[model samples]
Target: MKKITRKKHLEMRLQSIPSHPKPKVGLEQYTTPSVIASDLVWNAFSLGDIEDNVIVDLGCGTGVFAIASALMGANSSVGVDIDEDSIALALSVKDKLNVDNVDFVVSDICDFNQPLDADTVFQNPPFGSQRRAESGQDLKFVKKAISLDPKVLYSFHMASTEEFLIKFYSDNNLEITHIFRYNFPIPKIYDFHSKEKADVDVIVIRAELK
Candidate 1:
């Protein structure tokens, strides 16, 4: 398909996905904007490394990463999440984008099996602050990705969690190559005061498997 047609189709698919106030179990309900999606797309595309290599996005909220990877010429892309609603929305977006190179599945990261040899993996996991009791759940996703032998681009909370994530990556034999920092604006959750406070920053780290 022509690039323009593909672009328009993706735009429509993005519109189809439900925004905030809709809940997806095991996944936070942050409606990522086009700018953030583009940033992730560029990061993941840069890690393509080889032409037609496979890319996967763990906890792919709405399939933006997968969609962008397909557009950037990855041989194939897959997005895995436990949220059925998210899976449905992502599939709809794929149809609109006319991107047949990408697909999505509903599954938890811990229970996943590496069905394909992925050259790169991208992920935006939960900060594990809101409802998750564990403060370092994000690292599990990265660890699992590394175990699958894929270079990863992972988003994390830019607070003290940065140190924890760095150490975890190092321990797992993953090398951090680049860090993209941004102030992430989060929504006001139920009875959460800091939810509106801009105390939280975000960092996207690019890491390679050893």
Candidate 2:
């Protein structure tokens, strides 16, 4: 298979991937837009982090980042999600697209003990916006990614939590190398969402182990 070396081609390929069957509101299961996913993956590749690298996507809802990385030439990719339905859909999309370099696993981010040996981790974890009890769930994903000790990590977080995340990463011995801001689109999937689509300020932080 010819690798998708261009961002536009990668985005086109990502558009064909399937999304979550039933998006869980509590899990903040919003599909990352293809454009955004493409930009992030391309950025990682440009930084020499994706091509021929072992990549992992934590909380990989429908496996957008993982598949995109594989399409861009990751040696191997693993997408781990707690939702079985999401993993199943991701696997189906992988088969449909014949994306042989990526694999999906159903597992909680907290309990995941797989030997990742990953060079990079690209994840869009829950922003922890739904319930008060789940407010800091994003941190759990960050902590787990840090524990894996990948060479680099690209993670999404609410822009409002920028300060907190900066501190959290620093404290965990991860150095923030780049931050990309985006207006993430959230479609009306829950009863409480009044608007058809709302833009939430989000930031993708690229960090390296310190």
Candidate 3:
């Protein structure tokens, strides 16, 4: 297989990973745009954290980061999600793309305590804004990643919570590294959505263990 050395090619490949067929409002199931996922994964690859590493994507909706890491030559990529429906979709795409290194597990992020030699973790967990999900759900993912003892973590959160997240991560022995900001588009998937699409300021923080 040819290596994906360019960002555009990797983004094009990630576009094949489909979104949730029936998004649940409670899960905050907005798909991370291929553009954003590609950029983040590419940066991780460039930083020497992805290629040939054991990659884990927590709360992976459709396995965007997992599949991207596989394409970028990760040793293995594991995508975990509580929703079986989403995992099913991820499996189908993995098979469709013949990506052998990428795998999916259907389990709640908090209940995921496998002894994975996780080298790096990429998570875009729920922002915890939905009443159905407990607030600070993203923090749970951070703790889980820390427990996995990965060398690095990349997580996304609302830009509004940047200060809180930085302090929380520092308190937990995670050293602040890079902050990548973007205007994430939220499509009108739920009835409560008032616009066709709205942009929310989001930040993807890259942190390493202290």
Candidate 4:
């Protein structure tokens, strides 16, 4: 099968998400959802992931996953997010791609309309609460993915979250298919002027929907 890739185009879009109020500790920056999405997409495609599969991307910050799915020949790809700006940017990219296989919607993952037809889900939910300071937000996303009963689910999370996440999903009956670790660049405000940047280790978890 032929592979497709879309270039990142969210210069203005990134500006609209609103900068973090304070610097993130350890890593001064957080990874962009697009990078996370691309990493997931490449890995998924390498597994002979699926052709004409229904794919849903939750917390699709920039729609890279959604667009890549459509490009990869998924019968349908939908990206869902709570942020209006992010959704708008994603939609814009969707139009630019001119691929009818994908769509974007603005909604929270928990209450968003479920794609009963999807066989796979690709997501990069907030690694933690980061700006919001909430713990275990990844669990909420995992449960939601299982609720869809996809054959496979891919997610990017904090490396430190591995043990906690592994136990959490194991308790919930989800099995870890694979785990990939890499240095992830996190973007955040630094110093009094909020200009410094930092990179940290991030682990991407692949789990089978059992």
lDDT of 3: 0.91
Higher-lDDT candidate of 1 and 3: 3
lDDT of 4: 0.68
- Per-model TM-score, in order, reads 0.82, 0.96, 0.97, 0.79
lDDT of 3 by residue, 95-190 (tens): 988899999999998889877899999999998544456788788889988999999999999899999998999999999899999889988888
Residue 140, model 4, lDDT:
83
lDDT scores of the candidates, listed in order = 0.70, 0.89, 0.91, 0.68
Candidates, ranked, lDDT: 3, 2, 1, 4
Model 2 accuracy (lDDT, Cα): 0.89
Model 3 ranges off by over 4 Å: 129-133
Q: In candidate 2, which residue ranges exceed 4 Å CA deviation?
A: 131-133
List residue ranges in candidate 1 displaced over 4 A: 3-21, 24-26, 47-51, 129-133, 189-199
> Which residue pairs in model 3 clash with each other?
none
Model 2 lDDT per residue over 79-174, tens place = 999999999999999999998999999999888889969899988888865544368777888888988889999999999999988999998999
Error of 1 at 21 (Å): 5.6
Error of 3 at 202 (Å): 0.5
> Where does the lowest 10-residue lDDT sum fall in candidate 2?
128-137
